[model samples]
Target chain A: MPAGFSAADFLYILPELVLIGGAMLLLSLSVLVPRRDGLLLWTALATVAVTLVLVVRFFGLDVTAARGLLAIDSFAAFFKVIVLLSAALTLLMSAPYLRVEGIRVGEYYFLILCATVGMMFMASGVELITLFIGLETMAVSFYVLVGFLKPNPRSNEAAVKYFLLGGFSLGILLYGMSLIYGVTGTTSLAGIAAALRGQDTSLVLVLAVILVGAGMGFKIAAVPFHMWAPDVYEGAPTPVTAFLSVGSKAASFAMLLRIFVVGLPALAQEWSLLFYVLAVISMTVGNIAALTQSNLKRMLAYSSIAHVGYLLIGVVVRTERGVAAMLLYLGVYLFMQLGAFAIVTAQRRSDIIGDELKDLSGLSKRNPLAAFAMGFFMLSLGGIPPTAGFMGKMWLFGAAIDAGFIWLAVIAVANSALSIYYYIRVVVFMWINQEEPVGSPIVIGPAMKVALGVALLGTVVLGIYPQFLFEQAEVAARTLQGITAATVVGGQ
Target chain B: MVETIVFYTLSALILGLGVAVITTPNTVHSVLFLVMNFLCVAVIYVVLEAEFLAVIQVLVYAGGIVVLYLFVVMLVNLKRDPEAHQDPRRLSLVGLALAGAVLLELAGIVVYSYSREPSAPVAAAAASPVQGNVEQIGWLLYTDYLIPFEVASVLLLVAMVGAIVLAKREL
Candidate 1:
């Protein structure tokens, strides 16, 4: 019976089990201990940190766990680290913000942990149905978290729009899954690739690929499927928005890489073209639209879209270096994007509207540290020299060129130049534009400081010494290729 | 021949009810049509020898989901027709173009499959045709797909919490 349901199988999913256990425990504690505001936050952070340690301990030890539904290799370890770091940082940011926003419910932390667990599932899932369920779990949790500020109509609207569009996209993705399953009669990544070897491509399979691509495009906020991102990001709680933009986006990319690269290698030529078109349009559309945004959150939302464009080039290349570059870029993104949003969260108060561009006016005069950090984040996001974002762009564009997609590199470079204008505009408002600031020097709580400190350290360290993280990413990418190799051997 | 006749009759009923569900002006009647469509689809499943699926379809879709639909339709209390707000412009041409494209694609697939050489079936190894349908499904669900089944329960739990958190009048 192939050692079904053994103790070792349970150990493979220990991190997820810990998270779900922690989430449920917190759900109960929220009811039992209603007044302890910091209790849930601390517990959630500890849970994620513990999970991170377990994943790191198992890194590079290639093993498929939970009866081959989940992989515990370097690839999963790498993304587990990303998802955990983002979750921990978001929880840190959420503590102070929640207090200020009067969201006293401990279920807030519960939902965040649940979502993180879902993302962890997405990172490790080797089966299509498992990934789909993980995606839905994450999506459902986000639907609630986006509308966490129940009194705010914009939050409600964002939640409704996200849920409706998200459900529709899920349907499209399910249809694609069913079609693929119908054609190959398997939902396992290794099996799918094995079945596809030497099999002639058909029109229905192409259509399935497109449908699946479209669904992922929506999650990562690629253009033409990115209509919901800005509104959702703008209206969501800043910490949740940071989580969605970095954490959820990273998880989606991980799922995409698993499905398209490992499972559908035979269709690489077709899907890479789809990604190329998506990349070009996403970059162009995101940068151009961001130019006129007055809300800082909305501006960053568009900027995220543009960043997804640059990330797509890595997928288009379909090389190990390309995937490594993408993973590195995501790591860089987690720091800078979350750092920027953490600064925004620090400024939130009942008396002040913090997300407007004018809220940043004369920020340097008020809180120099905050302004300096925000300025650095904007610089990195714009891919300026000597920042992690710049290094990330270099790696991605270099990979594209190495793969002979010179046009993609050229377009990305042009888009980077175009992106600088808007990213720098935020800097200009913070430093040079001398309008009276709307709020007092925002109090940076201890938790916020910790979150900001970690983000800053990651961003600056990676920017200066990119070689270490790059090597780790390379290992992770190679682990992914190992799956394909195994599949090929199985086919033989 | 009798199986073919039953399949065609159920398919027509399902298709006709699906159209009625979308086109009907009255909200309650539309929901009723949807329930009929679900029941017809359940019957079609039965004809295909998927007895377990047919039972679940009738129970979950026709019985459970239809009740929920009726509750929502009545609770919303539509005073004015919902379709009245739609644009009055004659956009039928665009709809027709899209529908025609879909029709052409389906036709092309049918033609291609008919003309191509028959390939070996892929799933035959996974489940032997001699086994009972429900037993085969139950074995696979508990064995190969156990993790996803558990995760699906988590998803349902999250959805339940979401509905309560978002829809409840008071926090």
Candidate 2:
């Protein structure tokens, strides 16, 4: 073995390999199978299920693969499972939505699988280069997926804008990575942390940190770096938007915590201050912008940005409880965000785009079930009591308070209150505003129902009985804390 | 002294070409300037003693990517990219503020570096191993960085498939 490397290292990424193999198989079957209905969907779902099981096999593991380039720990495993679940949910909804869009390509599922695989890598990657590559994989798949609707000029325009802006942000990210490498002479997070112990804060390092923040700010759709998000969300195929909101956002948060907490714990005060500003501004801007949107997708996009801001409060806190709070919030967020988008996808038809708020008017009359699910998601998103969103927000803000950041908790609470207005507006459109008839009788396919059920169950069940999720999130966070503590001590 | 002058001349040329690539009004001229920029960057790689990197940069970036750029330019068949919509707001003050921020950051970096003791040890730069550049890189790629290398290949595969999916006329 070269430098204590073993073949067993490949065992650690077996789940990722399974996903890659399944993706290739999907693309190949697209060519060879000569099939049409539900074949790709079932296969993609099977791949996700298998990958999820494989990832669960690594639960509670705390080993480094390939000599610390990737972590195979409970922390990674937790994010991987959540990411895979979201991937499965996205695919479940994609069947009917893809049919409605008249796009039944095998490459569609393949790209989703590929993006999932990329996120899987992102959750485990311990090195900057690995994380960047994983980030690119997810980003590129989205750029193409956003434009999957070729005939629609809006889709084309969104794809171009996303590609250009995504490319620019990746450049900024890489430049920051290069600067860090220049200073530390290593690309691994632990290695960089080890090198920078007790070092004086320098301007170059500050610039590098800010650039990295800006780059990741684009990924998570924070304010001032969030110009591309609403347009991309509104223009993308609905399923893609759901996956982008939940899957991409969750994975990027994983990478963010990985970089900041697991690596830069020595500079906690500095980054804590930086993320404090990021949290406050993102919450205020995202909620304020969301209130004025007439388009449901655009509203959800801004709402998702606000949700991201709420999640950033956890990063600002940077304790075991904080990390656990983020994990809990993201878990519930996946369900609620995807559930809302599922309704949006169901409303889409051949004639009308059906994303306008007016399209949702009188939805309760057309389909009370869908309207009810949408109501649950909206309430959860607004952080009302007894919803998963509320439970998740409580833990996050509670952690902030415990960490002596009471002001942050207060700001987050105020923003959550402001956000309820728009969330309730969606509900009011569905139920109270009965004058405007929904143009057509809405149809809910079995696949979409399953997807919605999964999300609804997650949002409602986790909210009411969250002990299981709470315990698991703490175990996952414990591993992260252990590793960072070891690194800090070892470095000194 | 000679190396210093050479490095500065190449850097200045590369920066100028980069500016021209983005600023020039003509699409074809812009692409050709990009090609020149790539070539100059490859030369810089050679100057840094990474001959393999220089060759790869020439082959991949200057040769391969430029062809793709030309293909896009030809397919689009536009003299210049048309602006679809302009922001109603004239925000020159915002631009000026951003420029000032960047300038201040750069000055801070310069001043901080200059104020440091010249003999302060740079602990991060490990002593280079006595091996050929290509050999060292290859050995590391196959061993220490094998995972990232594999991931890069996967990324390229995605880009390839995505390009085909987006480019082909049919679904």
Candidate 3:
């Protein structure tokens, strides 16, 4: 016990601490409680609710604690809310499917909670080591989640592919960190920025930054490093797939923003060009690849890669407005993507697994409510106006133009237009095409219906009134301004 | 001079072990070689004066993860000759060329880096006592890096649960 290290430090981290504690509690309770039909479902909902409340209360305060490695700032708090809500929604969507598939397990919710904790820490991470640990935590948990249905050969294959690719990326990232550490002799982001000021840029440092960018690009499923996305997304359980696409991807972007904006601002001239090239490549490749994918999940996976390209446009600008737009885009993306996946979860049958594009044909006739929700989600994703997805892209590309990257913004808009073909293809098949009734109308439970409704409402409302999220994004962007501006000024 | 010789020798051994781990035909043999490679890495960590990390490298990577891999390989009951003989085809030729290209690139970078005018050693021996020792690292970990340290533990917890869930059918 050292001086000034009180229980107060632990209290500041109470939200994350509580989630970890809750996971252990749930693990024990799973044994005590009867393994009824809905036991795991109810426990998961309760855990997410308690964790969400803790996040809200923690964010309500205007305090920074844990020696700055963890910040209770609005930026981390916002992402924490997003991750929790996404996990809760995914769990809600998983209930009926898990029951149908006979794959219910207490460890499922525990892993989700733990992964959410990792995401929260990722957003708040102010140091390189913290970021790496958070990333590995998230990755390891996801590897298991992807392979949870171990008896299924496809699930096992997905897990192995994800783990190998993820492990390789981690090695690259760690190597980059070691290089940075060699140059700065420190792991703290603030210290690294300070050390970089006016220092003659070394080739080692430049290479290190590139490697770091490559690692992050892979995590976000950007082009050239996105080879694993479609297979992993297709093979994983639908709910886990939804969580990976939304919660984990958003967390990676959050960490990327923090690192590039706060830690490596002095090298903006060097890194921004790299981001620009990557953004173009990601958008072009992702859109072209997706045009041919007939598998719904695989297309979404490629579309996700393209979406990462759009988000990279924000990072390339290296401006406060760009950060805000990126955050806003991620928030909107959470709902739209999760909502689409939720509908897929509902459509699952005993014989058929994922909802292929053809499977969705004539869905409008069979389940009009689900079809309408899915339609809204697709429209939003395609960047159609008056949808949250469109508004999100608007903010992102607007920030790019504002930062004088008009060409990059133009490319993104073009990519957005190209995306519409495939996105609308799903809608057309759902509404216009016809297929035989495979089974009875899928009975969605109360929790899933509510989750879908909320996601739908969020998509429409955010699209209609983007100001609320934009304002929060603005504030979160400003929180890092002190570091960014100081670094730029010092570099000059 | 003696220290430099030892460093080079250890580096060569580590590299050799790494190559063996990758190219070995037997998966079990490859895993065993991986453990050896990990142990060599731990020795390198010790030489670098990262004592805590060295211990962790041995305990976690060499001891735990390798054992897990061995268990999986055993349970899978792979056939004695799981893979066919390597073909001397165009693809293999291309792979060899790519490997050569990578080696040349690395060599170029190393040569370029070392060509720069060498700076003074900055009293490496004296600095070692204060900076590279365990006490300094522990202080840093407890102070500025504390939150990440704790979060890493939580991450491990999640990983443990995840592994259990993946490997077992029931809770």
Candidate 4:
């Protein structure tokens, strides 16, 4: 509390402190008090809501704390809001599924909170070691959440596969960090940018970029590094799967942008080119792969990968509008993806695994509102008009084409068209399949109704009126530009 | 001259004790030999002036880890040979080849480091304001890296809680 970390520095990370303290309290209360899951859920939700308020309060502030290791700025606030919103939704969706599946909700909520804290740190951290720790914190929590249903063998398998792959990629990421540190002689992003400014790119620098990119690519489930995603996504609890796809992917993208744009702006040419290939391959492979999956979760997994590919196109353009486009799409994706997963959560019955395409049959006949929400989600995910997904992709690809990458935009549109087939498949199953339901009519809990209603509102309204999202995204993206121009140094 | 003799003498004892720890017929005796080996390693660390590492080597390896190993040995009580179940597709020869490759690589590293000229010390390391190595570590962990250090501790806490939850029979 004396020179380096003062009382005021704690004010900078007050949101994280609240989340971590809340998570620890939840875990402790679970152990001591035994079973008060409803109480714990309310507490967890309040904790996230409080943290959300705190993070949003810092939206326009450009402040750094912990001696430049953490920066609570507009960019961080944007992603922190995304992570917190998804965590809250995931918590809401988890209650009903846990009750139906007979899993404990206490540790489940704690894991979600802990992972949220990790993502917050990932967004705010400006130093490599801090960011890596943040990454591992989130990853380790997901690994446990994935394998949470101990009696289920598929969950067990998914946990092991994810842990092994996650640990290996962490090592590669650290190796890249070490190489870059050796070259630039600093772990701070601004320091690295300063060190590498006007310098000739070397082989080791290129290798470091690739290794770091690949490690992040795995987190985001990009092509060639996404072998574990389908299995892990399918095996994980449906709510956990939703959180992983949305929160983890967004946090990883935040880290990726910080490293590439803020840290290595001097070598943007190298990374943009690398991500160009990854974007093309990831989109093509992910969309094409989603076509054949019978299980709804696996299909969404592939589709999320394809979405990341689209997001990468925004990164490739490297303009403020491009970054804004990426931010805008991720913001919309938060709603559509989670809205889709909420339906899957609702469909989970006692006797039946509700993720199969056939499980969606007769849903419209059973509950028309849920059926409509599912169809709306699927249409949005496919980038149809009058939805947020269309606006997101339009701005993203429009930015790419505006930057003179007409071919990239064309390929992207073609892929979006190809992606429609699978997206329509979900709608077709819900709306067209006339078979009786595999299980009884789904009875979504009050909490889940709130989550679904929120997601639905976000997807529909954000699409119909994109002005609010665009303005916030433009502000956030421009904040990153400000961060680059002066480049934070010697925080005192 | 005296330090050299002591270093070599301890090194030989370590190697010989390591071999005996593996070959001994009795589990208790093997564990005792392991403790002795760990103690010798700690002594070597002390001789090299890494007092913190030496203390940690004794406390963690010799004291804590061996106790866990001993507990496992006591509980498992393997009556049959542990290696009796050999799979038909076991690639022992391939494993041996890989081990040999690693050994060769280590030898290459030793040869290369010894042959190469020692570069001047890195001038870029920001000079630590603290004096001692341990003090510097403490200072940094408490100050400059306080947030990261705390986050890492939280990581460990989550991992511990998660492992327990996953292994729990009932909540």
Candidate 5:
């Protein structure tokens, strides 16, 4: 154990403790008070809100606790806030949808909280073991969440495929970590960096890097490993899909950035090359495949993959500016992506299979507000001007150019243009195209409206004025820079 | 000479049983072969003087997990041969080729590392006050890896809840 570590170390993780404790309490209360389902939703939301507050309170804290298993710093706090925001919004949006679908509410909320707790842990973890546990905790919770609709055979199929593939990727990740352990004899990120500096580049270490990349690539739904995303996203409940697409993806990127930037910077050349190739492939594949997707959920899933590719370009730059841009982009994505999915949830009705693109036909005629909101989100996602998405893309691609990766910046620009086609297709469907509505008029609940309203406000505000969020991201990125500097000094 | 002979015999049994488990047509027979393979591994562990690990191999793999597999196989209907629905694709060939390449790479790494060091033989250390293998394990788990140990328990609890939620007929 590191000197001066004690039970007080738990205080550093108070937010996560509150989340888990609240989840278990809710799980038990749900059994005793099954009739008051609304109470469960509020309880879950309050837990997330309190955790968010706690995370915000620790904005500039720089401490490594649990004997360096976890590092509580600005980076972790930033990601935690993003995750908790998504969780709180998801809970707010879930109530009416759960009632409409006739699914029980208590366990659903419990699982969501647990998944958020896992994401918090993943964001905070500084040691390989801690990171792995956090990854599994989140992954396992999501497996259940994806399959929550047990009566739907499609949901079951998606769950099985996701669980099997997730478990395989996790195995590969652990193998890589074990190999690193064999080489460095330590599981701590700082220790690994200290050991790796000036060390010979062995084949085993390269293989470890490749394996780790593959595992994380799957989590973020990057190409060649993204076979599970479309099916799973389409099959899961819309709210759950929204959570998985934004919350889980953001957390995984947080973990990935930390590992590559802090733990294995010595192998930057090798991994950056890998990420560059992955970025191009993911962007091309995700955009091209999405062109043919008629299901709204499936299209969004592919778009999410493309976003991951863009995020990778940020990671590829391997600089504080690059990481800050990525963080800023994720913050923007949290709003626009969740807003898009919330609109999808609003389209759900007993008679309607809302995932189909045709279900959105003549949406402008029936519900102008929803159609406008959806159009705004799609435009933002396409990186059109005057939205968070465009500014984010600009910052990210600019970071690449600044780092002298001109070719990568060019590819990202072309990919952004390619992505605009699909994103605009959704807009055309809502605005220009007219098909006879097969279902009744979609009713937008207050909860769904609130969710969409907040998302819209965030998207528009962050777009025109990104300075505040960019400053926060810069602070977070600097915390990581401090760690790498320490590792370099310690290694010497 | 006797130790080498015993080691090779155990290795052959383990290798052959592993192959039999995969190749056998009957599910029950395949499971039996797996049990035999597990027992052979336990014996090999004993041969390496890891009695505690050997016992765990028997208890966990041979006794518990294999029995669970047996129950699952029996409960699920398998009247038709599973191979009848085989959808052989080009991907399978690519998968095989990749697997072979990985195996070769692993072999090369092992050989290169071994030749580089010719590692010195390890000497047994003095026993702790706990004395027994399990006791020592308990002590170390509680003292050195207390966080991970507790976290594992939490993981199990989450898994338990997940299983019940996913498998239950109704909420």
Candidate 6:
């Protein structure tokens, strides 16, 4: 209806458009194709391939095509790559499970792609409403995916709990947004920051900031707001759990980084204190909770929360190095979390549907490769040397200490030590703990094998050659200079 | 005077209905109350002159999502009310304490703010010549926010498949 609004703008968002188009195509193809499962897998693979290329192409391009609301900077580009890679890997891991469970359908891939797009957009969102919409997109998709195994009462329970909690969080988030809008008279993050410049602290403004922080804290599964995670993780399909633990959480962190570092930098002193408290609480609670969990998935769920706490160390610093470290940690975390989940999926035999502690008993004797991979993943998660997890923690905690958060770093490092015990417990269970075989060795599918290999390779490669990732992170961090400007404006 | 009346009325209705949505005995009734609450919020949006958002509040929240809630409620056919029996003694005391604390806090803030005159509202009359409503939202969505938007659509697609896989009689 307006001039200058060309189809070319649509081209700028080609990756997202393509994903939507691919989803629709898959929906129809599932109906047309005789073998729905094969068609779904192939379609999903094709969609991801196209999306990967688009993301790569968009990443290098210096085009900010969305009227300044949606940035196409290297920062967003880096996250786009991360989310897409995670989506592709998750889909690969999911295919085998769907096939085995005889629940293969077009919607599974479609939802995964949709959720990935949401994650990608969340990373690039410069506006509040856009970020909220993206978050909802991811969340709504997950609500369904978590309950995808509908017949299972546990799955249903998981989905219902996740949905109800997610809905409540959304309300809090929206209310917070409304308050922010009421104060700043704008929904744009930049506009809010600019308006808040030179402004004195008001009761309303303080409340708004706290509310927004609380809302985001819930999304990131920070302690006191992480109640839904363990149940959801344990109940959802293994692949969906992997996506939730890594993809969704990482996307939220992207938003958190942008909001705190770029949009509300002036409140750094205040929010950083809140983050410090959260980081300590999340790590302690998550680790302590994991220690008591017998279920492997639930343990991993709590561990993921603790990992979020560790990552918050980077946020507390609010420096360029801190942002860089956060991104690197997320990149490394994707590998470790997904790799560990893949091992869990691999351990699922015909009789057993999950990697219970008992299921992994004597895994070293039966499936030594899986056992070793599992060990490596656990070691990496524990921040053991020469693993991606260790390097990620080093960069993050190192940045915290560098920014004068020496005490926070000390606590995080201590928690990292506490974590080693539990992570090693899983390793010990697989290698040392002995139990009767419940079923024969799991028939590992080719796709899952490749997915595991990629995840493993990423962990080791990033661990060994950290420079490439570091440079990429540096570039990403540079784009976040706007955050400092935002914080100064909002804080005053 | 009219604005004050409308704001207070809408706020009370929203808060009341919101509580009802959560606390109602019948699950279906709770969902209905939620729909009512959403509608009231849409009206409040209208009062705020956010016409686009108000309409979306009705369409997405009231029409679409609330229906989903109703569907779940019906499908589940929860025989016994989940919160039918609140431990009367403890529950009522907890509720009373919460209400009292909230009221006290609200009163304090109201009293504190009563002294200061309301600041000049920003951009009260500079209606943008360019229309920026839902259409603009869509325009921005297709242009700048295209990738994430499309990704959201894909997520919905995946959700559909997942739902079918999970809900179907036999895969």
Best by TM-score: 1
lDDT string for model 6 (A14-78, tens) is 78778777877877887788576866887888887898897777654444556556777778888
Candidate achieving the largest DockQ: 4
The CA root-mean-square deviation of candidate 6, after full C-alpha superposition on the true structure, stands at 8.0
Among incorrect, acceptable, medium and high, the docking class of model 3 is acceptable
- Fraction of the true interface contacts (Cα pairs closer than 8 Å across chains) found in each model: 0.63, 0.74, 0.77, 0.88, 0.42, 0.49
Q: Which lDDT tens digits does candidate 2 get at residues A1-492?
A: 345367688788889989999999888888888656578788888999998998999998899998679999999999999999999999998887777787856989999999998898889998998999899999999999999999999999999999999999999989988998889888999888888888987778787888888888899998878899999999999999999999998899889888877767766666777888988999999999999999999999999989889999878877788888889999999999999999999888867789999799888888889999999999999999899999999999998888778888899999999999999999999888887574567778888879988999999999998778988999999898887684322100
Chain A TM per prediction: 0.98, 0.97, 0.96, 0.97, 0.97, 0.96
Runs in model 3 deviating more than 4 A are: A1-4, A37-39, A57-64, A486-492, B23-43, B50-144, B169-171
Clashing pairs in 5: none
Structural similarity of chain A in candidate 2, as TM-score: 0.97
- Candidate 2, residue A27: how far the Cα is off, in Å: 0.8
**TM-score for candidate 1 (chain B):** 0.68
Interface RMSD of 4: 1.0
lDDT of candidate 3 over B114-135, digit per residue (tens): 4645333354334433343456
RMSD of each: 7.8, 8.7, 7.9, 7.9, 8.0, 8.0
- Write down the worst ten-residue block by lDDT for model 2 chain B: B121-130
**Docking quality (DockQ) of candidate 6:** 0.27
Kindly list the per-residue Cα lDDT of model 5 for residues A1-492, writing each as its tens digit. Answer: 243347767678788888988898888989998779878877888888888888898899999877678888999999999999999888878887788788878888988988887788789888888888888988998999899888888889889989999999999999998998989888889999999999889999999999999999999999989999999999998899999999999899989988888999888888888998999899989998999999999999999999999999878887788889999999999999999999998888888768888889889999999999999999999999999999999999998888888988898899899999999989888878898886878888777778889999999999999999999999998898889873221100
Deviation of model 5 at A254, angstroms: 1.7
TM-scores, all models, native as reference = 0.91, 0.90, 0.87, 0.85, 0.88, 0.85
Q: Give the candidates in order of DockQ, highest first.
A: 4, 3, 2, 1, 5, 6
**What tens-digit string does per-residue lDDT give for candidate 2 at B1-171?**
986888999999999999999998888778878877876776676556555676677668766788799799979987654441254243355446644643554354445444644333233212324255566577777777888889788888889999999999985
lDDT of 5 at A212: 94
Please rank every candidate by TM-score, starting with the best: 1, 2, 5, 3, 6, 4
Error of 5 at B134 (Å): 3.9
lDDT of 1 by residue, A1-492 (tens): 552477988888888888888888888888888888777778888888888888898788898988789998999999999999999999999887887777745678888888888898899999999999899999999999999888899999999999999999999988998889989988998999999999899998899999999999999999999999999999998999999999999999999999998999988878888999999999999999999999989999999999999999878887888889999999999999999999999889768859998899998989999999999999999999899999999999998888788889999999999999998998899889998668656999899999999999988999999999999999999899888863221100
Each candidate's DockQ score against the native complex? 0.42, 0.44, 0.45, 0.61, 0.29, 0.27
Cα displacement (angstroms), candidate 4, residue A487, comes to: 11
